[model samples]
Target chain A: MNAAEIYKLSRLAIFWLSVTFGAVWVACWGVGVFIPSLITGKMPFLLQVDNPSTTVVFIADLLRSLTPILSLLVFIPINAMFMVLFERRSLALFTVRMGPNRHGFDGLAQTAADAVKLLFKEDITPRGADAFMFTLAPIIFFAPSIFGALPLLAAVTNNHDLFKVANLPTGIFYILAAASIPVVALVMAGWASNNKYSLVGGLRSAAQAISYEIPLVLSLVTMCLLAGTLDVVEIVEQQKGGILNWNILGGGALSGYDKLAPYWLNLVDTSFDTSAMFGQFYPVPWLSSIMAFVLVICTVLLFGLYLTGACAEINRIPFDLPEAESELVSGYNTEYSGIKFAIFFLAEFTNLFVVSSIATVMFLGGGDNPIPKWILDRLPLEPISNALGSLLSPLIKDLMFIDPATFWAAFWVIVKVYSIVFFAILVRGTLPRFRIDQLMDFGWKRLIPLALILFVVVVFARTWVVCHG
Target chain B: MEFVNVQELVSTGVAEALAFYFIAALAITLSIGVISDKNVIRAGFLLIGVFGGISGLFFLLQAQFIALAQVMIYAVGITLVVVIALMLTNPRLQNEEAEEEAIASSEPALLKFLDSIRNGFPGLVAWIAFVTVYMAIRSEHWEQSTQTIGEDNIAVIGRALTTDYSLPFEFASVLLLAALIGAIMLAKAEKVEDTDTPREGIESGSN
Candidate 1:
């Protein structure tokens, strides 16, 4: 209710974000580029590619492949810790309370402190527990989020050369498949604990995941149908023009209609070139206007369906019945202790980050600037940037501190993904948990049916819009 | 594509074969554990391990898409359901009865011998089946393709499902539909009970 308190919260949030991003950037560059270069310099045959021996080439290729993986390994834990801290701080802000500001620079290092405490705690195994499965559950839970985020790195970074090889042809499908593995881990953790509550929690998790996965997949399939490819990179490319071309606005379907209209109008004129006059004056707008309006409605519905399904899939608040503390005593992870518990904690936050990144890529147009080009071209910043570019060396310019496109693209992505994360945290603070029966009813009876209907409507309407508009 | 060196190919093949054997050994061991383990819930977990090992083998064969599908469908979906069912049944309840039976039968040596034979019957049949399958695999000649597996096997499989194999695809869908409807019928509560159930269930049950 207090506006000044909100402004102070935003300032603290921005400060913490910069510190987290600065650390992430340093870690990525050190592992992905610097360390590899240092190691490669010692292997002479690795550099001499003309007639290198087979083993040397193999080793070189293997090292090259490890670079992206090393960066990812370095990124996950650090980013997860940052996200946890960020969420806690934001939740505090929502309640008008100060949260965890004791450790380092307004509580920035609180997660690190918590990580240390978790490491020192006693790891326990319950009597009559399946010892092997009790140990393996957290690894299974954590490992998929690591590999799943790898494919999205390429799409999120606009296919940067360092991440280019990480892009698989069946990228989004692979991510989905990997993401599905964690439910098994939760069930394993629960059943292996030899506790009744844990067993119930695990059952709830599996049932929730299975029911919600249908709507989530349906929404993504609708977007893929509009984009015409399963490749995440290709899907982003299809939405590269501006905000209107984003998936939330029919995944460029309206723009596709726009392109088809000018040509078809020229054909229909059949006069001594009244087409030129029409192009300038814009006489009729019935079909195009109606189609655009319908497309917008479908897209809003699609985006809403995607957000709901994604929320349920990742076990976010209101949908987090599996781990509802008041009911199930921390649910499936009740018996997990020490570092194993930390891994579950880490993977949960990482899942939040992953889902937000997916939304940023699919609905908000991956790294594209929201501003259209005609307005951007009229801005006076270009002349100043040209002067600044002339003052810098090629290497410094390539380092991208001054490059306009990459800077703004990255700026927008950070803004979009973080905004989604903030929105999730806000929902956590505001919404109360749903009962299990209501949760099932909402997912199956409402969201899934809506998604299917939207998919069908978009399919027929897209063809009509493209061919006749 | 440029040709890979024969010597390099042989070395990589050796490495891949090593990985394949390791995965195969792990899978077989886990499958054995699935049957032999006294605790049914543990055996269910072992089944997941067996599936995971097979998925690893699929990865070694460079079938990435199939490997992922194997994990998603079998390891997560079917095996989790099995484990949950095993837990719900509380298999440990039968241990006391089994222990009492073992104590009672330990006295007569001939009766114990007959009991062992009865218990091992399924193993003997499984060993025989394994031998026959192994001999068949050893004797058959495989027609190895010269071309490498394509990069986009998912697309290839998708196209085939819609084109040449459309009838089979439709049949699979029909079978799934039947299963889904049957499951709904089995799980659905009676109409007379639905109203009472929701009131008790939502308001008082969970919390």
Candidate 2:
């Protein structure tokens, strides 16, 4: 083939490959809806007798497995774009002014427009800079965010697994390790920029990241200790009893009681029936229950610190001194513009969502159905009672018959995560940037020591309970 | 290295060829860049590429965790630290005349000896090590060992690290603590010196 013809052919090949990949992704979503049971074996409580054809089952399973990933692939860019718009609007609102109201449905398409502008913008290479590393930094930063999602979201089952591309037993650790990679890219970007401010920002980021990373990891380790597995699906399963079973509710010990008084105060009275806290199979040891309570409290505290640390690590507001626009001129990203800058922006939002999702799964009882059994039992299902039940029952029951409880639970998880994200955005809108020294001190003096002490308490409690029991 | 069937042999051969091509390309490209790049930062980044390619070869040899750890700690962490240091020092913007004078003063014989070692020794050792290790690995009865260890179990690794390698892990923690303390002291000393010099100058001027 002639050179021009060969170039055209190569271009066509690339186009077709991308198109085929996109088609497969959409097809997976369609198959996932109809034959999800085939992918995930069976619904949690449902039973099946005869098996489908192995070939058909395998194809369905594969498609179903790819669905969540495909959805995520589509979701990330859209989410990033919308979040940018959201942040702009929120900031405008906070400052009492309209912002970016022109372009694409009153700034609805602002992010997309910005993205296009960035794509066509000039790519600048600073003098004396390493051109290759400068170009490579953003790609490295973005790639890990995508790959990190793989292990975090992947689920597996015996016959079928739901929504996961691959299951790693060390899934939690993989997420931690993978997420840590973007820090390297940030440092690279700073160095490659050949700017003093960028270098300082990068140094500050590294120190801040390494500091917070300890507590973030310790919090996850605490969850692992409680669940006895690092697998995400298993962790969710342990929270099947809904909000009551959530680790934050102290394992349902105070489910029926008025939560006005502290748990320890209630425990001191000994008048209350603590039978509900004990397992049906075995009597709960008093010491173990107390230890478990202590561990849960420590976990919650560490989780709070972790969430704050994550916001800081991502260079979000209040702790966003590294990226303070006024001070450091966009901090480590000072020299970055166009698509390189967009990638960094995308990584930030993606990391935010990831942190929130993890918090949801660990503390908030992920994907658990929310309805209490007592409330369900109280509702009259008989003809005379059916009329009354219609009035008494929640509106959620009318929309879908597939147990509104689980739906509400999942909805709550989404709400909780979004709220955390919203709070992060609000902080960005409201709070002033911290000085770099203050940021470092907050990490080292406050967060690390607190995390370490909490970790020790958790370990000691778990060991004591185990030995006694 | 007995293959049970022709298909198996063909698949193995294809995989091996692909691996060889990538590894060889990476090694040549990175080594050339390392020597040619005038910028110290770029050279450090190139060294990361060399480490990464070696790690990929390790993965092909069925050391998946080790390969990942190598990439994580050395290629990402250590190399990033080096790049950061380079940026902090601002080597590229340093006085060119001073640099030229320093280079001119160095003995030609010593420089030539260092140059020869850098260019020649690593390449020779890499070639010898690759051929010997590849032959040894290819000729081994890997399937027999697979039967003994079972399939793709990471439990053994987890147990080994926590039990057999616990002492090393503890020692590593101590080493990190010491490093942290040392860094703090160095930083503090520099700050103290800066403050003391200013104070002493003010007092002498007042007197």
Candidate 3:
């Protein structure tokens, strides 16, 4: 918590994250843009023109189709490495200890080194273990993470043309469905291990996941009910104005009602058209304002529920009972070794990233500046962007390379998603793990009931707030 | 020219057709494995594979929500619960004990065949049901809907659930509630009795 420690951690985090981002950029550009140009002897941008050579069009299309998968493959491993370093560094800051400082620049290369070591280690299958399942389990656990986060990439990047195919109409639902598959993988690993500790661990994971999933689904369902659509892009679009419009604040409940209430009040008033007078006197109409307040409270509670369930789902600290070292000996993955174990490790961090991104899209405004548009308009950002855009116009507009909207969108997404990730790390630092019975009780008896009530309340309260529809 | 037509076919409708066949093949294979797998837990896991393949088909059909529901409810939730329960009960112990008994008794070959057939009765019934459904599908000249799922299918579902199909939806909810309550009561009743016996063992162990 010391200022110096925080500064050092932040600097370290930024440096590593930039490395990951750079690697992803290079890989994506190399495969999706440069290689196609090399092969076809034409720029991808030129292929977009009317009646371009069909061969050029086909090659570009193929490259575009492959970009999402290629970038995702590059992104996951690098992002996981950055997150591992971030968590260790943050934990060190909390505990007043230096963490992973021996390797490249405050232990940035530590995870990479560990990954190499893991790859070189022996992958062993026990004599009594189900060998096929033992091998397949980690693959099952890890594959969904890659696929599940694909749709979010589209939503986060403001539906960038390259990622538009990932944007299913049932976006968040597909992600949730994919996310749920990992617990099955955990159970499979546990049962296939032929070890008692692994069995117990896997069972605990299954129970915890199934129980907590209710609250998580309920909270997201509540957000969907408020937003009135399942499309992640549309949901994010609805929350565009400011902080007040974000789903965390009832998806613009107050701001929208403020606009509509004066007119409705004037319609009822017989004395004169007192709508202007009403606006002048009571700027925040009382009844709908009260409903908006309730909506905000419910939204906040649902967001909290979502965060808790997400933490549990990803098996982060405070909900890592399945892998509670004191009890279950690393739980379901006790017998995993080498690359199998590496995949599990990678998927865990990737799941954390995916969960954070989901929260950003659903609760925080995805790719939206927190600053209101009016204030942003008053500022000199547009002119600066315009100047920058003019300078890069040839590279941007004609070449289809650097769009300011996509740039800002990606910037804000990174900011919001990483902030959520930092908050998760903070929670891990502060809270102790829950006892098994306590965890069950909290998920089933408390969170689920609260989430259900909040969902019902939002269902009713959304009608009073005009923007929700 | 023939090659160009073939390529065009692949570029247009062949991909979807290929995908449908691939997923259908996978589901059929996995379903067979589910029935034929020797280990109960492995069979349970195979059930998930079958569900996943079916979900892929649902995805190909543009039933995205249904595809997701199939994965969530059938592939992950139900199959995981089944597998966990099977593991917890230690079905291997029962199988080992059964094997020992069979060894001791030394059943005749004909009887053994009959016993396996008896055990396979459920599988036979499942096959019959599948064939019946397959035949029905083949016999019907189905008019497949030309309409694709719109962007607001979820909204359509929500409105339908509340308006046109509200009664059935409410009835389904009631049935689920009933099932949940029944399960809880059964569990609680057993727990009370089990706890009473466990208390005596704990007291004696402490002494």
Candidate 4:
């Protein structure tokens, strides 16, 4: 909320996110890349073989295929734990209070301790509760976030071969469908809780998710329309040139600005016709230019719309009506006591992470460097960057263990994703929760019509302009 | 156009067989539950599982767009609405205790058996439908297409909807719009703000 709070959030995010990803990278490299390479005799020159036996080859193939699930299983818990602690610490900083500092170094292990306590606590089914459904709710709630986010790993990793299996032709649609499944779980949780407050919470969740989902989906649909693809990896690839090429910057409606600025500086260069270049940017002369300008404003509004709808979809602050703690008594999970409660809690944070990843991939340009190549070329940092690449090349060449491209992709993805996460935490610290009726009115009356108009405008204007770098 | 088989994603006939049998069995059980369950809300939840299983079957057929649409529209959207409608209209979610009491003082076992036999009417209807479908399958000549399914078949479907099937598509849109307006009118008609009559009890306090 304050500048100091934001600074603290950035510091906490950078430290904790690095620790989380650093551990994930090492573990994933060992299991997914290094060990498989060793088994197949593809790395560590001493282990190299012209032809591996069929059994060894089969084992390597299996290991490689299993990597995605294994890595996600490992990553989700740790990342959730980090996010919980980060949100707490950031919230505490905002509120000017100390948070969970006694557990470990600066309270880093607080969530770890909390998770363990939750696991060992008694998981209870209320006496009147439908036992089968009560047990199944959390599993349903938790499963989609994992499978739904699998395709995202491909987008975040620059479509690494091992992870690309998760990438479907209808990628974003698959994630969206998967994203919707958790609502059923939430309703099931509420009903099976055998409490009035819980049932109301569940019903509220169903209505809220259903209402907000349209705008949430439409906002992304607009981006997908602009980008002309549903595949997250393809969307990311299209946004690769720079920040201006990102969907947030009108999905390359203004890339002409970035492209033509250099032409402006070189106006004296009569070797190439400036008028033809100008014509190239403005296919319909003044109309194209005006539409391109309008497109930029619309895309920026779409980004805001996406963030708002995503917050509602994931039940973040200003929209967390389902589990509105003061009224609902922990909402649908009210009767859930121990490990089941932990699973619900974990999935909630994971959903937030997945939403941020979607925004990053669709709008902010997943894993793409924000700095334009034209700027980078003139920055006098080429040697240092080349040196850095060489430093990473050994891991790819000598060990055949890590693709440098994947490494950098993962790096930018972490930075972008965690930045969004911190922004969400900021929203949580700042905004008051909306009354349920207000939430409905905002979603139905305001967001939906705006989204539809944006979609139509983007569709019409997109034809007159070049989109995405 | 050819087999970009989803079964091959599992890579062997074993996974294919396993997935098919598992989903089919689940669909059967859940559909039965939807009919037989005493609680309407629980039955609605069971309907979701049934839709999920159907979506899984669609996924196996390599119609992923349809499969995902199945999940989004039917499994999540329709089922959620059904559940909400049940919640709003019939507040009693579970009638298990009353049903248990009714069963405790039920008719004789012979009468129960006779009723069970009578309940086989649905089975008889199902058989007739199945036979019709089986005969249709037997009469039709099936051919495998030579063109392989392109990776981006959604674009193909989109083109067909806009061009070849545009009339039907437009008609469908008109029908949907009609339904939307009708629903609004139905809802809005009840909002008669008459201040003529003052209610005298707690019922008036609710409004």
lDDT of 3 by residue, A320-372 (tens): 99999999879999998888999999999999999999999999989888876
Write out fnat for all predictions, comma-separated.
Answer: 0.42, 0.12, 0.55, 0.55
Q: At residue A408, what lDDT does model 4 achieve?
A: 81
Error of 2 at A338 (Å): 2.8
On the 0 to 100 scale, the lDDT of residue A27 in model 3 is 73
DockQ of prediction 1:
0.31
lDDT of 4: 0.86
Assess the local accuracy of residue A256 in candidate 3 as a C-alpha lDDT between 0 and 100.
56
lDDT of each: 0.78, 0.66, 0.84, 0.86
Model 3: runs farther than 4 Å from truth?
A30-53, A257-285, B1-11, B92-131, B147-149, B191-207
Checking candidate 1 for backbone clashes, the offending pairs are: none
Residues A144-214 of candidate 2 have per-residue lDDT tens digits of 77777665553212112344445556567667767777888777788889887887777778767766677
Per-residue error (Å), model 4, residue A387: 2.6
Per-residue lDDT tens digits of candidate 4, residues A373-410? 66765787979968977887887788766677888888
- What order do candidates take by DockQ, descending? 3, 4, 1, 2
CAPRI verdict on model 3?
acceptable
- Winner of 1 and 4 under TM-score: 4
Q: Quote the positional error of residue A20 for candidate 1 in Å.
A: 2.6
**lDDT pick, better of 1 and 2:** 1
Candidate 4 TM-score to native:
0.90
